[model samples]
Target chain A: MTAPEVVSEDPEDTPAVLADEVEHVRKTRPRTNEDDMTLVGSVLGGLATTWLLYERVLPFSGALGFFVSWYLVFLAFYAGLTAVNRPRAVVVDRVMTSLVIAAPSVVGLALASTVVVTLSHGLPALLHVNFYTHDMSGVRPSDPYTTGGALAALVGTLIEVSIAVAIALPLGVITAIYMSEVGGRGARLVRTIIESMTALPSIVAGLFIYSVFIAHFHMPRCGFAAALALAVMGLPIMARASDVVLRVIPGGLREASYALGAGKFQTVWHVVLPTARPGLATALILGIARMVGETSPLLLTSGASSFLNWNPLHNPMNSLPLYIFNAVKSGVPRNEVRGYAAAVVLLLIVLALFLLARLVARGRNRG
Target chain B: MAGSSSLPTRTSLRVVDEVEDVPRRVVARQSTQDLAFTHGVRSVGFLTLVIVSSIGIFLGVQAKPTLQHYGWSFFTEYRWLPNLDTIGIAAAFVGTVEVAIVALAIAFPLSLLSALFVSDWAPAWMRPLLIRLIDLMAAVPGIVFGLWVLLFIQPQATHVAHWLSEYFGWIPLFKVHTDVHYPIWDQAPGFASYEGSAFIAGIAVSMMIFPMATSVMREVFSEAPAGEKEAALALGATRWAMVRTVVLPFGRSGIVGGTMLALGRALGETISVLLIISEAFKIKWNILESGTATISEVIASKYNEATPAQLSALLTAGFVLFLMTLAVNTVAASIVARSRSGAGTEL
Candidate 1:
């Protein structure tokens, strides 16, 4: 090949000339100030409206005040940003202006509506220390507020969920393994069927269990049957989630394991399963959350009990969902209060599970 | 000649050795069979299929008697009084369909707009906060939403009803009834009671499904390829025009799938409908006037007191609900499959 071509450099070229060109380039670019401001304004306006509405309309003033003050602080920050004329100044200006315009009226309307509702419905019964410690066996609508608590319902819910997890976890995990690791044509067919089952309604699961255990076998409604019904609801979700998590495991890890003379099962257990553990945990917790809030299945299978029933097979179990359903159905003022309390408790339980699952997922992601 | 003779002798010896290895292979196969038998994943998968099938089979068997008695006639008959031996699911079916349609009509546009706001219109800093709020809305239980709407929204709807009558009395839908006993017009003009009406039930169901649809649509819209949007922008399109032409077309199948899934959810929703709809089986076309029962509501309300015939009728209704859900789910799955295949080729 011929020798490489050589080029001569211009002696007049200087660092100052390059710097000036870069600066000129930067100055010619169009600024996004107007676009960002409009966006920020609209967002602030919407949030201010929603926050004001939710707060003033909340059943408790405590939550309302907490949120209102929270939004105002954010509003102030926006105003400060705008005053500083930062790159994001237009965004801040828009937000502050929108909040100033929208917050008062929405908040006022929400507060007015909430007051009317509170007066008509009265305050939800205070859940005292004993509310978590007592059973509802002796409680009546006309009885004093000290009659009993939802301790039994709490215990029953725990037991039902525990048994449901026990049944669902291994089955779901194994099914997922089959779908992701060893799945062939037959496995695909099985997976399709399971996925279809995931969308079956809670009521249908209940009716199926009710017909099988109660009508045909002459069995009484019990916590075990309820747990079984919940397992039906939880299984497909757990299996599908687990399958997705398993499929997402990098192929390199599996190859590394196989190169170490590990068998298929060993590779799956030691390498793949650990990698997907967080997602699996999330799936399990989600299953628990889903079953915990289900009322219809528990209604048909577990029935309802005022008192605690530790024996899953022998007695009707008191669960938060069942308790809420019964209280609402009773249509007594005291019962409605009880319903709200139970609802709050149920919501807390599901929220706790979801948060825990998310934490585990985040931890695994970092690793 | 001596080397050739040695080679033939070695080959004969190797052939003899190969024959001996066959029995050893059979023994190895038996051990592998034992290994496979010990592992339980395959067995567990099989067991799950069996259990799930048994549930469906058991329900079918239990519902067989009702099916045999009514055959195909049960669906068309409207009356549901079992003590008098008159039972049909026609009115309940109509109410169910009507409520689902109306709720979808109300929820679809609202959710689409909300999704657009969250995905495209919101500021970068605000998007996460808005998404979190949407999540909170999704997390609120159906029963809680039903209670809130019943107590809060119903009163406002009544006011709107009165306003419509006062300002636009010529409309048939806004005609006011003056009967004091019925109380359609007796109270404050707008404050009509919806104690057990289809309209209230529809609104409650709409609220229940709105968050799900919005979240799904938001995800689909956000996932649209950036290049397509950029191309539209480069060709001189407004933001709304770009969304209408590029984003919507890309997300149409996804939206349809989401809506169908929501429809399935609405069909099976029991608690909200039970709280809002009336127990009556009568069909009233006027949305603001009266309540009509749905299949889910009827089952929830009457399951405890139902006789064998009535119970069978409910089971039949359950079967119908199952079929409706299956159809919707199948359609959604097919759409999802089609989109996935299309995406694969494009990628």
Candidate 2:
């Protein structure tokens, strides 16, 4: 309403006023009834034409093909319809707007599909009480879904991740502290090394531990070895995250501490770490998230086992990722179902960690 | 560091030292605790450096035997026949690049558009939520993506593959060798040939890396000079035009750096490709055909069944992959670090 009135009164002020006016407007144009009709007509025309091409004129078939052709046709119809009335810039802007909006919609749909497909496929396995309590010790792939569970893999995951957390958390924190608080030539070197370590493939981490621990040292293929591999994978992530967090702490806090005659270590311990506590927790949880879903690192280190194993030493243990990998590729339909079920559990756990990290980080932002 | 900036320089302190009986030095007295702390932290830092270097050293040592045996031919040879004592990373290396290229093709545009949406187009209240959702996507496990692709996407995607091969089959990459000709494209070109192809695997890996690349680009795009954006808009440019003039150019290096980082990740992605691809050891460019191999996938698959000699060969391959990713990541990190958008942003 205001756009046309303003334009009619002072036509030369149109571009500048409209540009400022657009800051308040939600869209480039205040969509009119005619614009709405064009959108609806183009869509309908696109669908009709696509149906004619796919079903009658062209031999194209399949839902994906139909939808894709329809979308392309719809875009064309829209461009043609809009070009008839609007300027070239407006037409291009409108097309780009639709495309920009469509991008996130596609991403959202992909996420929804992954969750929906995983839940739908894994629901049956979750329905069984035995799926949580019992291990797959004697349960064959031929056995019914009620007969076995991922308890062993769960136990192994808990033990391995616990050990990894114990090892990586402190080491990672120390490394971060060393880089940020103890800045020097050595700190720069360590920071560079840590940055590159983030790129180390998870499988290579497992191989490194395998070659060093089992092959060279003649150690057993056990949960402990897997924990070391997980530590290797998690440490760089943890350190890098912590370094960022530590850097974000106000420099004024450290200066105040030093002004009060506090030593470097004192400032770090009493001022810096305390100020960045929630952030450090976020980093730790994010590190754990990275470690939990890792399969390749455990593949070479922790040999798979069917029974529950609590200890990190002496014997083979199975984690959720390895269990899922083995189960899905087992070439059995029943086992494949269980694998999907395990994946659902893993996904839920990771989602939970992500939420926790977000919550903790958000709290720090507010403080 | 804040305190250090305020402290006197060594030359200034030396001038003070030259004045005897006066304050001989301006240097603050180091407490024992501070000295101990410095040493302790430095040693721990060096220990981490040692730990990291040892990985490269260990792989180097393990790869030595294979390097000595196969010489430079190890990288050039495409076949892996342990029995014949002929193994090389050429096929897997090419496949890795092919898969990474395809993933970049799909992921880059989506990430860019979505990143632009999140940074500039999204409502203020919705921005954080969208960012969190992208982060959550990153948090989703790769193996789950493998399962999704295997059970849900692969069957559906084969048709899309057929569509590509039908229309765009003139392009060598889209060309899949099948008896069915172009005119009878509606007739099955054997969807079996399309299953587990590089196209499908790339789609799977693209989903995995999309979040990672988006976050980087979004971070940089959001940091584009707001004043310039408004100036462009005030000069009668549309929002898209403003973005093109200001944000895209500002974030150009960020896009390259982020995409390269994602490419490094795509090259290292193991489980999804391992599941989706049917292993074929040849240098083929037909992405629509049903066979591909990546270095990480080959390592995971062959490590279990490999003999001692074959194990050395696998380690040698791992070394190459490590070096490849290392180089990419180093260059990417340097670019990201040096980019103007990153100057005011936290790393």
Candidate 3:
């Protein structure tokens, strides 16, 4: 076909020729130097402002200063770009409009949370060392001695949590192993039920334990009951964790054991269980961590005692969580101090568990 | 045919000769015994189920008396006075529901947004950091959160209430009496005090619930099919529009599951609510003015001091709470099952 005939039919030739003419005209457009500089300036300005806001050399309120400075810099950048390159104004305006619309909600939440945290915790955390060591005992409401250390409560918490961990770990691990390795249809059903039990509230666990041990069994109000309650609370978590670990073990190992003339029990004990040992440990630790800081179950099952009791069965044991609870509930100033110290301790314990879990997981991954 | 028959006869003769060898029969019997021993290992798995069920049975037996006495009226009655033998769980039920609903209302949206920011909108380097921050928040025990709120948040709440009355007294919720010496007062005109009120409890509960909901939602959001999001974006949709259309639809069931999980956590929370609120069994409608009791808090405060009848009543309440949680979990599991089935078909 001839070039003109290929380009257009007799009816379509006019529009095609006009579109090519318009394209040729547009290609001759020029760029301005000021537009380039404006782009560079905006980029630099955003970076500089972000750096200053984050670096914290100046005594500016962290959240408020960062937000205000970011917006102002962004606004200036958009304005500069618009002034230099009018055609790009639409893009800049759209971006700026959305940011403006969204900024308040984000900034407002950040600011409110920061202010709350500072006012509530920051100042009191700076006050007396008495909050750390003393109990509410002997502290008079009118006297400066109204605040005492949380020593007794801390001891109580340690004993209660320790007892809880002792009960939860073995039960959780064995149950998990059963579900994954030896469980048949009935076993699977049991696992499903246990998984469902994960949704049981802490209080229900407490009430259940209380009714069974304290009311019906006539068990004394002590750390042992609290431990039982927490163990029940931690069971699902431990079972789930152990089950996941067991399932992840390769089937080839089990088959190899059978080929070597090992029995099912022997294979599971020596091969499957060993391979998942790290995860099992992690599960146990997690269970301990979960029950250690639980307050509700402990509150109902383990009556609060002001004095430290090492024996789980003899007397009411104070746990860190219970200590904090009792102190704060009393609405005494000294108790508030003890409460904060206990809180700090409890936080540290949780943090330690988390770190330990991460470490074990990493070791397993590497191994 | 004759040759094949002779071969079969020869093979049988060889097997019979081998069986006749000394120790062959003994080995076969030993193998049978070993198989039985292996089977015994499998039988022990039932012990876990036994332990779990035993707990349930024990609880049921203990709570029998109260359940028998109240029949169904226990749930509907609003009064809870153990000394007067007029105890009912109505006020505790209301407090539990009110606190849970209000906390969820506040935490749900913020958590969704925070999850979105971390999983989708955050810069690459910031994602891990934000995730760790969230994990840290979750790691903090409920007891610590309660202590922080009581010692720190209470004073600020008082000041805020005072400021609100001074500036925004026209608003009903913020009204405060200038003549009152306490920063927060129960009898402030048109305004309720923060002391032992549902509002404080709700905020504390919200703080406790936020980390759980956020972490779950983040995981769910990040797991959403990439193609779905890309397809929405390809249709000239904005980031928010894409999320609204593709991400949210896929995550709806997950969000529901997560919320139910969080509801379980909130329902069981004892120390925080107990420390922050008055253990009063009054069914007050005002969030600010009323001191309300929750099931967990009531049990915690009264379990030691309760008479036999009171203990039975508490056990009944405990049983009800247990059933409520089980019902919630069943619904959640069904929703999850449906979503999985739906995904299977799509695949």
Candidate 4:
């Protein structure tokens, strides 16, 4: 494996069999058989030379600088070495391959840095047990990490998001059923509308609710209103995803039930819906994931409050997203840490929801 | 599962007797079922329609005052100063388009290349993992990305922005006289208050929108007809050549649709843009300089503590943002629909 293999195609290129796997229509992926030691050796050499040369002229320091520069230097060194023996096409292919890989590597770096930074910055507050139990009441942002917790924001978020789910889940599932099962003349239009609704921005959703319920109707800035705003944003997502899940249900299942002398209604109720239940559950999780971290919508609909408010109907309620949104803007280190802690909590919840979605989806063995 | 025995042609019996024999007895039962299901579903279905309609009408009604006040100037004028009862969304509209264009420019090509690799070029073991990575990018909350940009990217981005302004200043878009505020470890104070510039926001948004573009293009490329790919390869085409001839042209509509979809998202993006850009009322040509305010950003930043007139103005801005996204989405939807047809019903 020291030398690169330039074979265009071989029997080894056979596409792996996976359920519902598309793509890989062409059973040809160029093999890169370069020696691991040489690759790592070149990268190390590139790093040494780049550090020496760039230390004087380049304005980068520490690991970040090394990490960023290694890619550029390593690519040049690796490709330049490869071009010494390989044809121009092989060199070009290898370079392009590295560049493509780099795109995602950079994105992965950003995502990882986000999580790590959030976790590390929030760790101080998280070490305290009361962080989850206590509210922000009587807690100063400048006070020690032992003082305040995200309890109020946590409860506020739970209430708002749950209420939103309470409203959106049933309606969204019903709409999805309508689209997939009872589709008719307005089905196309409803579908288009739902698709567009999926594009509806959080701020816009907030503005819609703010104007209609708050300004026009004089509704208070309560968690329920915030929930309504979230519902508006979450419904189309749930409906759209559920419709997709429902559509993927085999038509033959319906036919089988019909063959059993079951009407369309019975077939849909007993066969289609039941069979697609897992998928629908995934859709529901995804919809909740979509709305749970929403900030702009809650900011407008639910006025921020520092105290833990029990009633969501008549008074201001603070959500975690909005709390973070407010806290981060203060530009204080402690406030920033608090925001980061809240963010980590929200991120963990969304991660759990997505995992649940994937977990629930595992039972469905699509043919 | 659509078992083979259930196939109509495979059936020994026409099954008409099996179906018809029970219908007479089951009609009563099924009619009630049908009525209940249809009635239940239709009412909920109609509610969806109402929700959609109401979102539009409610926003429109709220925007009426602003629209009446501004008339055509609402869209035409560029200056936005609401407290003094003088405002128009011209600057915000241009800023939104500018930022979105810059974002698309960066993200579009990268997403296409990534999608190509994930769908056709990557090793079998890597493809699913990379595809899942793209999905993960899409699943992450926008606020997390915003915070990342704020905490990490902005301080580092100033160097790049400074380098561009220093070297590529000959270009109009790059011509800016902004100071580079390096991290305090290297220098004194880091942020010069303009760290969250338009270009930074654009790049941050590119990260956010990249997943969407990749997903669409991956789906399109994956749907390329297997027969055509085999033919292209059979004709002695290289992998790249085969992709160009077989996959790319097939996925062209999908690419356009994906780009347009990403563009729409970038336009209406609030949290990230709000976090990254310093609010400004007027449009500027230099992307590197800070003070970029998009329509959605304007609403998010200004909705609180806004006077009635200001609130109305922000609503008008939100409405405009809505319509713009709607137009983009409709186009994307149509393009995707057309691409599905062009894929020739393999779905």
Q: What is the DockQ of each candidate?
A: 0.19, 0.49, 0.27, 0.36
True contacts kept of 1: 0.18
In model 2 chain B, the worst 10-residue window by lDDT is B338-347
Question: Could you tell me which 10 consecutive residues in candidate 2 chain A have the lowest summed lDDT?
Answer: A1-10
Candidate 2 TM-score, true structure as reference: 0.92
Model 3 alpha-carbon drift over 4 Å, by segment = A1-148, A248-263, A266-271, B1-45, B155-192, B231-236, B337-347
Per prediction, the TM-score for chain B is: 0.80, 0.91, 0.77, 0.85
Ranking by lDDT: 2, 4, 1, 3
Give a tens-digit lDDT track for model 2, residues A191-277: 988999888888888888887788768899999999999988888888888988887777777777887878888988899898889
lDDT score, candidate 4, position B202 = 89
Model 1 lDDT tens row, A1-367: 3433334376465554554545342455334775457447644764675566556664323344455555665566555555565445344435534443443234234334533453345234544666678888978854555667778888999999899889988898898888777666756776887877766777777777776677668789899999998888778778877887777777667666655756666767788789889978876776677677777777788988999889999979988877766777787878777666666677678678877877887888699
Question: Model 1 - which docking category?
Answer: incorrect
Q: How many Å off is the CA of A303 in candidate 4?
A: 0.8
Best prediction by lDDT: 2
TM-score for chain A, prediction 3: 0.67
* Candidate 1, superposed: residue stretches over 4 Å from native: A1-124, B1-39, B124-139, B161-193, B234-236, B341-347
Scored by TM-score, the top model is: 2
Error of 2 at B256 (Å): 0.6
Candidate 4 stretches with Cα past 4 Å from truth are: A1-49, A56-70, A73-80, B1-30, B178-194, B227-238, B341-347
lDDT of each residue in A107-157, candidate 3, tens digit only: 245334533553354235325666556654665533453355556667777
Candidate 1 lDDT over B265-307, as tens digits, reads: 7877777777766677865554555557787777777777776
True contacts kept of 2: 0.55
Q: Which tens-of-lDDT digit does each residue in B72-149 have in candidate 4? A: 988887776665667888888888988898889889988888888888888899887787667766877788778878
Q: Candidate 2's C-alpha lDDT?
A: 0.86
